[model samples]
Target chain A: MAVLQAILDGLMIGGVYAVISIGLTLVFGVMGIVNFAQAEFLMLGMFVAYYAWAWLGLDPLLAAPLAFGVVFLLGAAIQRVLIRRVLKAPEVAQIFLTVGMLIVLENAALLMFGSGFKSVSTPYQTSSLQLGPLFISVPYLAAFAMSVASGLALFLFMRASWFGRAMRATAQDPMAAKLMGIDSDRMHMLAFALGVGLTAFGGAVILPYLTVSPTVGAQFVVLMFTVVVLGGLGSVAGAVVGGLAVGIIQSLSALAFPIQLQNLVLFLVFIAVLALRPKGLLGGAR
Target chain B: MNRSTLLRGLGLAVLLAVAVATPFLLDPRGYAIRVVCLALLFAAMAQCWNIVAGLANQVSLGHAAFFGIGAYTSTLLLIHFGLSPWLGMLVGAVLGGIAAFLISLPTMRLKGHYFALATLAFGEVMRVIANSWSGLTGGPVGISVPFAPPSFAMMQFKETRPYYWLMLAALVVVTLVFVAIRRSKLGYRLRAIKENADAAEVIGVDTTRTKITAAVISGMLTACLGTLYAQFQFFFDPDTVFGVASISVRMAMIAIVGGIGTAAGPILGAFFVIPLEEFANDLFSSRAAGLSQLVFGVLLIGVILIEPRGFMALGSRIRRLFGKGGRP
Candidate 1:
């Protein structure tokens, strides 16, 4: 029963990881660039959610769209002004630039918000629902629900929408997308904005449950990277499955070993997963 | 061998003379010695990083893990048993090298961000272990050497000048190794791999072996520096030993600023970055505690954007200025 409960809890937390990892993966998929600054988008999103709760007394869920909107514009602007200029440069320049952006965003947050860890005070934080020998907090359930719904909506959009097809075409071959009369540049910008929007939304959703701090985004960078790599670098579905697996392993490892040693377990598992399935479970041969 | 080479040798001799005279020229206080020692240590760390990152094209964001491993190993051995740190430091280096080897075995397969992420995870894991492994590491509070130990066997120096000279020697040794490596066939393979791994592989270059060799050498040197750093500081906390800021970003930044692939790049980078950091630290503390890091952060961004080629590139520019009769 305890094991089952741990697994359930792990799955929900994994759902949050999935949401975050998918956002990062999408950007990489479309742009052939990894934004080391993706975590800052999440950080900015958390701040948006926090301010919305404090000033407007709005629920965190409803504030996610607001957070997404702001971050989307930021992402689009970055794509237009900074990333687009260096789109043809060596990938390392992009990596360094993104790292630079990460520094800017993180320090900007520190300057603006200070180092205090703030919590988004919500009524549902304390509430939990019992299911057979297991218990689930309302916030965790809500987070899981939000993640699943978002994932489904994103999946459906990609499958059916023309914008989504253009993104896919661009991901596969930008030149081809251009040949097909799609504005590849616009598609790239939109993809980046959409990706940042997802990360920000994930941040807003998770803010009620987690602490919001200037350095909070750093905590997710490793786990999110692990998820993205394990799911296949650019595969959306892979990220979702990988995230859940990693989450369960991490939570269950706590039960098996000291909490401090739990990360070691995750690291070991990460190595094993990489060695066994380099392309990830859902990804084609990389 | 040539006019430029003769001039380079003369310049090195002059620099060596200045380094030898610096302790006497400056105050003989421990704090000054500490700063100088730390600068040399950072130079060594940056040089090691430049091997894999600069030459082998593997951006390891986890050099601190090796540094911490060295610090923990030497300190733990000395504190737990009556082991001499001189011998223990070598053991520490080996252990750090082995850890790097283990980490690289799988992670080397990962390209770009995945490779960096794997190393990052390794760094965090090492830090957590250092923090919680109370029996070995003394937990977070950390282990310290006894003050004024009876023998040189304990590796305790009576005066700051000795440590300064020792660190200077280490720096010389590190520079020699970097110069040697850059001239070797391994260095050529590294350059080729950095340019294009697939092409290097097709050309029959053992890309994996070259990368692993670079990583191992880099890890060992960094660990050796870590051991010296622990001895000099007289304390080894997990935060200080395994600090991502200290080990990863600092060394990488120096290497980046100095010249990523050049033999003299990281040394030049360390020279500028350390002094600049000290200046910023001195300036910002009274005004704002967090502002120094903010300034450092901004400077880092600006440098990457404006001058990714770094100081070594600028050194030539300076030389050209003199060559063009523009005033030294």
Candidate 2:
């Protein structure tokens, strides 16, 4: 019963994990360079939502689009100014450039917001629904619902939109995509923006349950990477599977170990995955 | 010796003289000397990183695991059994080497980003263990080295001059190792592997064994430096030592900024980066909390943007401009 309940709770939170990590995999898909600063954008999304709730009395769910919009622009600008230069550089340069961005974003947030944890007070913050022998936290359920909706919307956009086709084309082959009249650079900027925007959207939705701080992104860095690696680097469908698996793994490990050692289990799994399956369990595509 | 070799030898002697004489010129207890000491230590750490990353192109982002292992092993030994840090350093090196070997066995086949990601997770695992295993690591509050009478045995000294010299010696030793490796049969094999691993393998290079050897050596050297750091600072926590940004990224950044593959690169990088960072911290700590770190991030970005090959390339470019038409 406890194991079943843990799995249930895991799925709820895992939905958000999937949404947050999709951006990471997406950026990797479009641009071979992994944005180490991807989590910082999630932090930014949380801040945006926090401010929206505090100043405008809007719920974080309501403010999720705003967070996405703001971060999307920031992501686009960053891609143009910073990431573009490193596109052709060596892997070391690419890695460090993103790391430098990570440091900059975290410090900039620290300077702007100070080193304080900010939380939102929602009416459903402490509420829960009992399901026979199991229970569902309202915040988790709401966040999960938001993640599913956004994820579905993203799927629609990818399958139905011309821009999505162009992005996918670019990811497949830049020269071929360019010959097909798709602006590869524009696709890159769009993909980066859209990727981080989705992650920021996840950040906004989870604001009711999780506190926002400058260093909050540090917490998710390894977790997100684990998810992406498990699902495969560039595969969107894989991130969903990876995220749920990670969430379940975390919750189950919580059941077995002390709370402090929870991340230790995750880190071990991450290393094991990377060591054994560098292409990811689901196999990599774009 | 030829003219260039003689000139290089003369320059090194002059640099060594300057280094030995620097303590007398500055206030022995001053912050500047402390910064210089830290710079030397970091340079050694970066040099260790360069042996693998710069030479073999196997960029590791989790060196802090070995660093933290070194610090904790020595400090714990001191607290528990009254073992001298000198002995503790040797123990730490052995353990670090073993840890490196264990990690390398599984991850030796991985390359580039996959290798980096695996190593990163490895470092975080060490940090989590250290933080949680409070009985051993003393938890997040951190551990302080017990103050004993100023002595060489404990690796503790009252004056900063000894530490500066110790760090300089360490830098020299690690730099020598780097140069030796670069000139060795192993060095040529590593370069071949770096250029094309599969091709090297086809030509009879044991790619896995060579990579594992480099990683173990790098890890062991980094651990030794960690002991030096433990003695220098006298207080540390898992976060500070096993920290991603503080130890891992900083070491890699130093190597990258100076010149990745060169013997002089980490030294050049450490001298440039560490002092600039200290100056930034001094200038901005009072104004804002994260301002100094922000400056660090900006500087890293600036360096990457200006020259991905780092200061070594910039130096040659300037020399080429000045020596145009004078040399072949």
Candidate 3:
């Protein structure tokens, strides 16, 4: 019964993890460049929602779209200015450029927002729903619902939209996509903007439960990588599967280990998964 | 010797003389001497990182694991048993080598980004352990080296001058090791593997073994430098020693900005980055908290965009642009 309950709780948290991590995998899928700073966007999103709630008296759930919109524009600018320059550079340049961006964003946030951890007070902040032997926190459930809704919207966009198809075509082959009259560069920009925007939305939704700090990305860095790697890098479907698995694993591990060791468990699992299957469970590319 | 070789040898002799005399020129108890010492120590650390990352093209982002291992091992030994840090350094090197070997076994086959991510996880694992296993690591409050009577055995010194000489010696030793490795038969194997792993394998380069060997050496030397750092600072914690940003990235960045695969590159890089960092901290710490790191990131991005091969390549680029015989 305890195990089942843990899994239920894990599912809720895992949904949010999937939404945030999909952006990372999507960027890799489209451009073949891993943005090490992807989590910083999530950090930005949390700050956006925090401010919205504080200033406008809007719920974080309501402010999620505002977070998405703001980050989408920022992401597009970043893509145009920084990431686009590294499309043809070596893997080292790509890795460090994002790393540089990570350092810059974290510090920039520190300078702007200071180091205080900010949290929102929602009506459901302490509420929980009981399902027989299982208990679900309201914040987790709300975030999960938001994640699912946004994920579905993304699914529809990818399936039914011309831009999505064109982006997929570009990912499949830039040269061929170009031949078909699609601007590959434009597709990359769109993919990057959408990718980080989705992560920001996830950040906004989870703000009721999680605190916002410039360094908060440190907590999710390995966790997000673990999820994406488990699903397979560049595989959106894989990120979802990996997310639920990580969420459950984290939830179950909490029962046995102290909170301090939580990230240790994730790190070990990350290393093991990478060692065993570099391509990930759902396997993105060769 | 050929004229170029003769000139290079003369240049090295002059550089060594200047290095030996630098401490005398600077105020013995002053801040500038300490900065110089730090630059030398960091240069040695970067040279060690260059062994694997530059030569083998492995580009590890987790070297802090070995560095912190060395630091904690020696410090613990000294605190508990009054053991000499020299002996502790040796022990730390052996342990660090073992750690490198252990991590390499599982990750040797992985390439590029995957390799980096795996190693990064390993470094964080050490940090988590250090922070949680407080009984051993003193937790987040950090550990202090017990003050011993000023002595050579404990590797503690009262003046910045002796430490500068010590750091200079360390830099010279590590640089020699780098040069020797680059000229050895193993160096050829590493270079071949770096260029084309599959092709090198077909030619019997033993790519896995070669990479593991480089990692072990790199890890061991890095551990030695960790001991040097622990003694120099007189105190440290898991975050500073095992830090991804402070130790690992800085080491890799120094090597890259100076010259990734070249002997003089890390030396050049350390001198530039450490002082620039100090300058940034001095100028911006009060008004803006993250400006130092912000400056660091901007410099890194600028370097990569301007010259991915770093300043070594940049020099050649400049020379070629000026219509010299240097290759672009």
Each prediction's Cα lDDT score?
Answer: 0.83, 0.94, 0.92
Model 1 TM-score relative to the real fold: 0.93
Compose the digit string of candidate 3's lDDT tens values, residues B73-153. 999999999998999999999999999999999999998888888998999999999999999989988999888988887
The regions of model 1 sitting more than 4 angstroms off are B30-33, B150-153, B314-328
- Model 3: pairs clashing at backbone N, Cα or C within 3 Å: A231-A238
lDDT of 1 by residue, A32-54 (tens): 88888888899999999999999
Superior candidate under TM-score, 1 versus 2: 2
Give the range where candidate 1 chain A is weakest over 10 consecutive residues by summed lDDT: A88-97
Deviation from native of the Cα of residue A168 in model 2, angstroms: 0.5
How good is the docking of model 2, as DockQ?
Answer: 0.84
What would the per-residue lDDT of candidate 1 be over residues B1-328, giving only the tens digit for each residue? 9999999999999989999999997677746566777788888888888888887778877899999888878877877676888887999999989998998888877766667667777888888788888877788897786454645677688778878887888888888888888889998998998888999999999988888998999899889888888888888788778877657878888888888888778777887788777878888777655566666666666666666777777767778877863655
Please give the DockQ score of every candidate, comma-separated: 0.43, 0.84, 0.84
Better of 1 and 3 by DockQ: 3
In candidate 2, residue A242 scores what lDDT?
94
RMSD of 3: 1.3
Residue B176 alpha-carbon offset, candidate 1, angstroms: 0.9
- For B214-296, candidate 2 gives per-residue lDDT tens digits of 99999999999999999999999999999999999999999999999999999999999999999989999998999989988
List the TM-score for candidate 3's chain B: 0.98
Q: Which pairs clash in the backbone of model 2?
A: none
